[model samples]
Target: MIIGIPQSRAFKWSYRAYVTLFFIYLALPLATVCAFAFNDSVFPSLPWEGFTWDWFFGTEAPYIGVFHESPILRSLVTSGVVAFWVSVLAVFVGTCNAFLFVRHEFRGKAILYVLMLLPLIIPGIILGISILVFSSSVANFLEDATGLWFDGLRPGLILVVLGQFSFITTFATLVISARLQKFDPSLEEAALNLGATHWGAVREVTLPFLYPAMAAAGVVAVLMSFENFNTTLMLVGSDAPLTITMYDRLKLGSTPVLNAVSLLLIVVSALLGLVSLLLQKRKD
Candidate 1:
């Protein structure tokens, strides 16, 4: 028997197959990683020994869990602190820049706008190196001139925050500016006509409208700062962030603890995403 050609049906089936394969390809590795987190193996790779929580909470010999791991825990703390500060600072500065760029047209408005975006165009490594060099030069100058040493400006968490901020804030500015573009200018004008001062209008009317966008930008800043490796690696001093610690550990050897950390991160990220969705739903 000869089969009849069904071109349209075949095309639809082919399209669905492609999409299914695409998603499976993306999800399979992550699924494997999560599964490996529970595997009771010295190594994170295949041939699972058994299911165990040794990697997550063990305080004993070879199976010492991530919680008992001091260096990794310390690096995790550093990542959190840096991410928190970076999120706060980036949102504040980026919101200010977004308002300035959207609301005003000064003499150098176009030039300043381009300058603000330069950070996004630049590579992270270059930004990190530039910041490190600039800070070192300033520290040296201050020491030579004032004869007072200041290690605060050196390569450390502060430098890491600054380095991440250099690009992250640009990201935030773009987000806030996009949201600001959709805003109706007349509302602010109406507030002004109703006897509200410029600052009052901005504080009460404008910022409330921008809260969702700012929150989203803040989330992006935290995630970026937490996972940042290239710039962070260059700027980090004696104390490293989670990404740096993970990299160092991989360089030495692989372990199930790494998988445990990855699993924890995935869980935290999922929780954050759920919270964001709930907030957005309420707003809607």
Candidate 2:
């Protein structure tokens, strides 16, 4: 006896197999890196020299976890602080843009949206260079006129922020736009009819409705800022963010300590997401 297949069923089975292979191809490397991150080896190689958190706790190694180093810890803290602000700034401004684009009708709105999205389409390296040059030019011009030098123009923390914010805001805008498009206009109408002021209605109903999307967009902005390199490279002044510090470490030769750093970063990001999830659960 033969177990048979129809043409359509066979096609579906084959297509499903292809999709499974595609995802495995994409995910296998990340999974491997995560595994290697826990390895006790001196480098990112695989013969399974055995699992160890020695690097994590600085139990044994030349490159004790960066967490034990003051300068590296400083850079990580600086990056965290900057990323947090960028997330807040992006969400605040982007959510407003989304509300305007989705709820308000005005002249040249289509043209305006195209402009808002342009930065996201631009290459990050180019964006970084452009912001550096443009800010420096303005800073120089201002100094020439008034002899007041603004250090923020120098590729540093402020410039890194300004650069990251450019594209991150666009991301936040898109996320909020997606949420806004799905918003129920009738809810707003109903609230207004119930003697709620427009501001009150928006503050209570609209803001709460958009809160989760805002939080997600904010997380994306923070992740982008934390992992940022090109723009940070061009814009960082005398100091470095964690990404830049890691790049510098790699230039001197990479070790499993870098993997330790990456693993710690992954854990921190996961914890942040977990905190958000818990807050959302509480709200629910």
Candidate 3:
């Protein structure tokens, strides 16, 4: 009995130790990055340089903060705009697709559904290339056939939006459709038997129930759009997104400024997560 008790205690201690080490492994790099953001050194790597707020809050020329860095700030604004529009468009299209796939059955439905989901499995790089090539071909064909110029066909914000939407909308559709499938068809039938029209029944009954799923899907869409790099790299033009801008800076030669940007993003992401958790808890 004494041996068994000791063995159990040893197992518990070992489990806790493993968990602690795992967390430390995950957090060490992030902690290092945050620490170096405030380091007085120009480079992000450190030899224990004295602390300074130059990276985050410097008011002077070379030591400009993230908010004061015009190029980074512009890139951030571009990212925000792209993410916002992507989320809105993805949600609208994906919700419609969910309804189409889940609520109705038609000929070639299986093939169409497979085609829609194909984007999810395709590599981002390949998908980006395909989109660019197809767009260019279509643009050329239209010019040759109709002789009418489609000015928005070039590699720019429109192309980026379309490229990101290809996969993001698929993700949203899967989320909303999963929730939609769980809904009972009898509710709609009951509403129809009463005085409700089809649109009215959908708006009044199914939509309210689907709100939570749609909200979650929208959040996912926005986050994915904001962080997407591979597809955006191909589609972005002179006006670059945050990820592309960061990549360019890294290639040129990284500075503590990158660390500062990382820190701000980490804090903002944490706050967003906390707010989302609180909202979910309140809803529960």
**TM-score for each predicted model, relative to the true structure:** 0.91, 0.84, 0.87
Q: What is the lDDT of residue 103 in candidate 3?
A: 77
What Cα-based lDDT does every candidate model obtain?
Answer: 0.89, 0.83, 0.86
Candidate 2 lDDT over residue span 1-284, tens digit each: 43675568789899999999999998886677677766777787867888877666663346465557566788888999889889989999999999999989999999999999999789999999999899999999999999998888877889899899999999899887887787788998899999999999999898888888888888878888999988888898777899999899889977677777777777778777775555334432
- Predicted candidate 1 versus true structure: per-residue lDDT over 1-284, tens digit per residue: 54685668889799999999999999998888889989988898878789999999998877889999998999999999999999999999999999899888889899998999899888889999989999999999999999998797899988999999889999899888877887888999999999999999989988988888888889888888888998998899998999999999999987789989999998888777666455333442
The superposed Cα distance between candidate 2 and the true structure at residue 216, in angstroms, equals 1.2
Task: Give the lowest summed-lDDT range of ten residues in model 1.
Answer: 275-284
**Rank by TM-score (best first):** 1, 3, 2
Candidate number of the best lDDT: 1
The candidate 3 region of ten consecutive residues with least summed lDDT is 275-284
Ranking by lDDT: 1, 3, 2
What is the Cα-based lDDT of residue 272 in candidate 2? 72
What is the alpha-carbon lDDT for the whole of candidate 2? 0.83
Point out the higher-scoring one by lDDT: 1 or 3: 1
